[model samples]
Target: MRYADRLAELDSCMLSDALDNLGLPGAVAGITPIWQGARMAGRAVTMRTVPFDGRRSTRHLGAAALERAVDGEIIVVEQVRPEGAPPAAATWGGLLARAAVHRGVGGVVVDGACRDVDEIRELRLPLSARAVVPFTARGRFVEAAVGEPVTIGGVTVEEGDFVLADGSGVVFIPAERVDEVLAVADRLAAKEAVMAVALEEGAQPSEVLGRTYEEMLHDR
Candidate 1:
């Protein structure tokens, strides 16, 4: 099945559980979607950026990754900074959001900050980030690399890895394990749907979900 189709069938929770069942780690922490219903699923186009030093060359932050990304690929950016230091600028913003939409990019996930959130919301692109800052990337940072592995919120994302993001959060699926993860996620989603129906029909949550949840997780 197409990645988008598979993503439509699962949410971050289901995929995260699937990853856990497979003993994999892909749940990103501290990154929240910018909009209430924002969601995306696509291959990753990873990039890394570092705090700017006056002597180093500056490229339009994220330009390389955006330019190279194919349709339906989400940009995953990792901000490189000194340990314990927070970023002083936005790594993503409105212009990039518009550009990504125009290019048919699925969305963007930043391990740092984003700005022009109002404009981004108007553009209606799915975005997840650590914080919001008003500063621009012009002199605050530079793109260090594109199409490479980048760590976002403690999760390692590589180019072409499956990226699924929604209100619950973002999760990455290793490119090689996409099929396996999807299979388990599908099963879990089906079981969860059954449980949801049972609850609506007056079954107690603990009785219908608690015991069955453990059994489903361990099954197969």
Candidate 2:
């Protein structure tokens, strides 16, 4: 799951195709990059937030996750949403983005909403989430757990898993299948590279794209 540099070399579509070839579930749905040119990959460290009660929390929402994460690791937050809770609570914001950059975090993926889109963009932090809301989580949500499995885009994500987020979307790689998926994705990327060159060399669309693309997807 520590294949950040290698994973970043490929796009989400290539990775999704690789996952399909392996018959695995990793493509996260309903979430996307919060800014233009967003992309990052790293080991995951999760933090879950729940509805806040009157009781005070010893630490802030993302503090524990950041404290536990190392360089080239991403923070995954599960912001649970239910009725009667704050209607506009966001799981991430500007401060967290700054802290993440300072902590050397590769990026952040939230299951729920995020705020401070402009500030986060200014910091150039890689943030991918479901929505961009202007509400604060302070009075509505509190950190409930860390380093635990949480759902992101309906996909259960665990600590130490691989996370790849980009302009297309986010995809979580199972910790055990990182090498397998990477190998297939690399092969597909190489084939596509050759195809691109052929198309540039005046090869007809049908000639260059015979059946190799579909064959590769199924033949693995």
Candidate 3:
């Protein structure tokens, strides 16, 4: 199925709640900031590491490997930085972003940084990362590992885990929990849709959202 179609079927809010249930950290905040443009839906290509040191590098993915990527597979790179030290350099940049989009790669979810913010926003491909920088990985880093487990934001993602990111944030649905998580997310989305319709129909804010949402959503 198309990634956008799959995303269209699920509830973004429910997906957020499911991540909370899973105890994953980065899904809620800065690490997974959603890039505007195309929505991403795909299996993960996981990698594990810490701190994006410029000294560590991988051969830029060659054409053959790039061609291997399809609709729902993300380039999941990780950085394992020490408590006090920060990520070394921007792990992704404009060329990489364009290349990923060209290959029909679903998106990129980095445990570090990205560059060329305006250009990436224009490309409209899905990208989630820690921050943006003009300086990027050139001779510094290469693919440490592919199709291996990687940690991002505080989540351990195994290869082929179902990945989703949107306005709410990014979440990793372990292969084991995909069914249940999708189900709950669908329910939450359905209710939110109804609430949206009612609000448009002139329902008062308090009546549409009610005390539960007003209190619980804010408290969290």
Candidate 4:
């Protein structure tokens, strides 16, 4: 599916609620909001390995591989493991961002560090990462592979999985569960909307919350 279409289907509210329920790491609520230009959309090109290793034979797929993805395919890189000594250098940089833009890649999601923050912001490519650093990752590691299953933010994102993200947050909907999750999200959104209306009408906060909780449980 087109990235925009997936994004539109999931919508910002659904994505936000999913992140809230999933507790993914980088679904940051308040931070330096970089990708405010437009909401990015894409299927996941998941990569779980982290901190580009200085190994030979790493596939520096570079621009060609990046551009090869269908429109709205966001490069999703997952770290090999959640913790340890952080990668010494940035996994991606301005060059990749520029290349991705040309290729119509939706955005980039790194479970590790990324460099070229200023440049990336200037380019206006959506990026979600653990942190930013000045160190570079050239001659260190190559693409090594692509289209493999990778995990990030406690979510096991598979290749070809649908990814929907915006300023609110990112959500990974396993292909098998997309329809189910969307149905649940729609119901939850409706309940939340009613609760919001009650709150605006001066209903007690606790009552509103309690009623909402009861409704969610009943729906289940």
> All models: lDDT?
0.86, 0.88, 0.65, 0.64
Model 3, poorest ten-residue lDDT window? 56-65
- Give, for candidate 4, the lowest lDDT window spanning 10 residues: 24-33
TM-score ranking from best candidate downward = 1, 2, 4, 3
Residue-by-residue lDDT tens digits, candidate 2, 88-124: 6798999989999998998999888899999999999
Candidate 4 local lDDT, 43-95, one digit each (tens): 77755443346566535434444755767687877545326656566677898
Each model's TM-score?
0.94, 0.93, 0.76, 0.78
Model 3 lDDT, residue 87, Cα: 61
Model 1 residue 218 CA deviation in Å = 2.5
At residue 15, candidate 2 shows an lDDT of: 95
Model 1 poorest ten-residue lDDT run: 51-60
Best prediction by lDDT? 2
Give candidate 3's whole-model lDDT: 0.65
Which lDDT value does model 1 have at 190?
A: 85
